[model samples]
Target: MKKTVFITGASSGFGKETVRLFHEKGWNVAATMRSPEKEGELAALDGVLVTRLDVTDEGSIAAAVKAAVGAFGGIDVLVNNAGYGALGALEAASDAEIRRQMEVNLFGLIAVTKAMLPHMRERRAGVIINVSSVGGRVTFPFTSLYHATKFAVEGLTESLQYELNPLGIRTKIIEPGGYRTEFAGRSMSAIGAGGIDAYRQPWDKMVEVLAGWPMSGNIREVADAIFEAATDGTEKLRYPVGQDAEQLLAGRVQMDDVAFKKMMVGQIGI
Candidate 1:
């Protein structure tokens, strides 16, 4: 019997690539997105069942899970990957924008995980992979809202790992650095007329450097990390997935706060 994996935000980016990789490896794939109609290529794949799933919608999450179990017998792994970046100065962003960011990035993930827990617990075997970012561990200038959300995910996944490990299930968080994907284009948002004025001069320079930094890793690296976390039985809790991610993690571990800030300013020319 082929193992089944269910992935959210599977229409594009790391989610889409993971679906392809797992399908090629002979696993049954339940690839879901907000617009199933937009997943033409993924739907045409050999072992994939594409479905409509809006993570922020509880009903949509339930329906997608039901459809996935019906199609693949059961889901052995769940990848939570549907999220966007709300980038702006904290004061510049509206209350609604902050709430929206939390709703999609934090609450939405919780909703899907809550829906899937019963099924996984019953089976006594499962993997849960949350796609976080370096921002989860480190901060950036204009991405306060986005960083807050990722930080929440980091804590959520870490806490869940301890709780679930005793129940024969595993949870892992992937903190990837900048990757070449539609993430920069489609999933990023900026507030109105708040470009450089909203932040201090140094902060604006840091934002500029981040915005211009080349994406060093592709989707394959993240997908591969997800795959390894799902299949490997080791006790590794967090996997930082790219060169920038590794460096960021190292710096955070090695440097004090003041030193880290100075290093960041020097390196980014801020």
Candidate 2:
């Protein structure tokens, strides 16, 4: 039987590309999104199940999983890609912003994993891929919340191995560096220390620095990485995509904390 892959945030970006790639590879795909109605082609694709799934909503999670399993028999892989970045000065973040960042990035990921655990555990097999970022391993100013959740995802996936590995359930984390996805357009919120004079200069510098960074339009590379993670069938845990991620992460691994901090500080220019 053909394997199945269920992906969250499949409306666009890496998730959408992954859905198409998997379908082209002749694998079943469950393309779950918050607004499936907004999507037109995924449902029409052969062996694709387009459904509603909001990671923050338990009911939606259950429903989406049920729909996928009902149609495909069982999900061989689960891709957790529904998340956003709340950038800006830490002080500028409101209560709602903080909660939302945590909910969609961290809590929602855990909830989805929990919902899939029983099914995978019973079968003694499955792959769980969490979409993280270079920020998860490294950090920059004005993005504390995004880093926090991604860092948590990194740690969470790593720790899951002790139990999950034994159960034949492999886990992988995708850390992409700079990507020209809706990440900056729709999937991000830039709420800098709102009008606070002390943060004005710093905010400008941060924005300028970020705007100069290289973000690739080749997002299919990331989807390819996700597909590899699902089919590689190895115990490998992390796949960092993109040249920027590869260089930064490699530099981080080679340098000590102080040296790494200095290098990152130089890059951010703040």
Candidate 3:
């Protein structure tokens, strides 16, 4: 029997690519998004069920899960990829913006996981792939809120892995860096209630750095990582995708705090 995977944020980026790859691999895919109508390409694919799912809304989450289970018999994999980047200095961020970031990136992931855990628990065999970022493990300027949310996800996934491993459920975190996707465009937001002048040099430099970076890693890398996390039974809890992610992880571990910060700031201007 073909395994079924339910993926959130399937309208674009890693989620959409994962849906395509998994469907090609003969898996039944539940490709979910905030607006299913916007996912016409994925919805038209064979064996792909595109459904409306807003992770922040409990009712929508429940409905999507039910629809997914109904369409594919059961969900063998759950991919949590519905999140956005909240970019700005922590002190400059509004309360509402901060809340929104946490809601979609951290609490929303927790909500979806809780909704799907029962199904996986009953089956005693399932994979929960949380789409985090290199930010989860480290921080950068103007992305403190975004980093906070991913950091929370890292902790959440790590703890969940320990709790679920005994129950035959697998939890994995994919921490990718500088992936060429709509994430840098559609999924990024600037906080504060003013123009870019407030942040001045740092903001412009950060934007320039991000814009100039090589868009080498594509969605396939992240999709492949997700596939491996779902299929591989290795004891490794975190899969750092892309060269940037690997280098950043290594640097943080090997370098002293001051040197690491200096290196990161110099490399990325963040």
Candidate 4:
């Protein structure tokens, strides 16, 4: 039987690429996004069902899940790739921004996982791949809110590994470093940043360094990692992609907190 994969954020970037890769590999794909009507290419693909799935909305989540299951029979894999980074100073962030960040990144992922758990548990099989960032494990100058949500994703996936393993469902986290994605544009929740004077210098420095950073990593690397996580059948919990992610995460382990912060501050030219 052909396996089915339900993916969130399928309208663009990593999500869009993943949808194409899976369809090309002969798997049924539930290519979900907030505006499925706006998507044309993925909808035109063979064995692909383009549906609307807004992670922050529970009603939309349930409906999307129902639609996927109804079309594909049952989802063999669930990719929670529907989140954006809320970049900038913590103090500069409004209350709505804070809550919205959590709502979409952390809470929405949890809710979608909950909706899928029943079906997976019933069958005693499934793979859950969460698209967390390298920022989840390491901090930078102006990513306080993004770090908060991603950090939660790291812990939540780790904990789910323990609880879900015995039930036969596998959970994996894909931590990609800076890539040439919509991350700097549309996927950025707060593009207009910096109102606080205190954080201005460091924030500006971070922005400059981040801009200089290469967008050389093929976004397809992330999709390949996700596919491996779903099919590799390994007990691994975390897969960090790109040279940036590998280096920073490795440094995170080798150095102590103070040293790590100093390295980061130096790199960001703070």
Per-prediction TM-score: 0.95, 0.97, 0.95, 0.97
- Hey, what RMSD does candidate 3 come out at? 1.6
Residue 22 CA displacement from its true place in model 2, Å: 0.5
Residue range 1-270, candidate 1, lDDT tens digits:
999999998888899999999998899999999999876888888779999999889999999999999988999999999999987677777889889999999999999999999999999989999999999999866678899899999999989988898988899999989888877678877653365463667566766786789797567999999999999987687999998889988999999999988887687875
Clashing pairs in 3: none
- Number of the predicted model whose lDDT against the real structure is largest: 2
Ranking by lDDT: 2, 4, 3, 1
Off by over 4 Å in 4: 191-194
Residue 21, model 3: lDDT of 94
Full-model lDDT for every candidate: 0.88, 0.93, 0.88, 0.91
Q: Indicate the worst ten consecutive residues by lDDT in candidate 3.
A: 191-200
lDDT of 2: 0.93
Q: Write the per-residue lDDT of candidate 2 for residues 64-165, one digit (tens) a residue.
A: 999999999999999999999998888878999999999999999999999999999999999999999999999888899999999999999999999999
lDDT of 1: 0.88
TM-score, candidate 2, is 0.97
Clashes of each: 0, 0, 0, 0
TM-score, predicted candidate 3 vs. hidden true structure: 0.95
Candidate 4: residue 103 Cα off by (Å): 0.2
Local accuracy of candidate 3 as per-residue lDDT tens digits, 112-217: 9999999999999889999999999987878888998999999999998788989889899999988788777889887632364667777777878877987665
Model 4: weakest 10-residue lDDT segment is 189-198
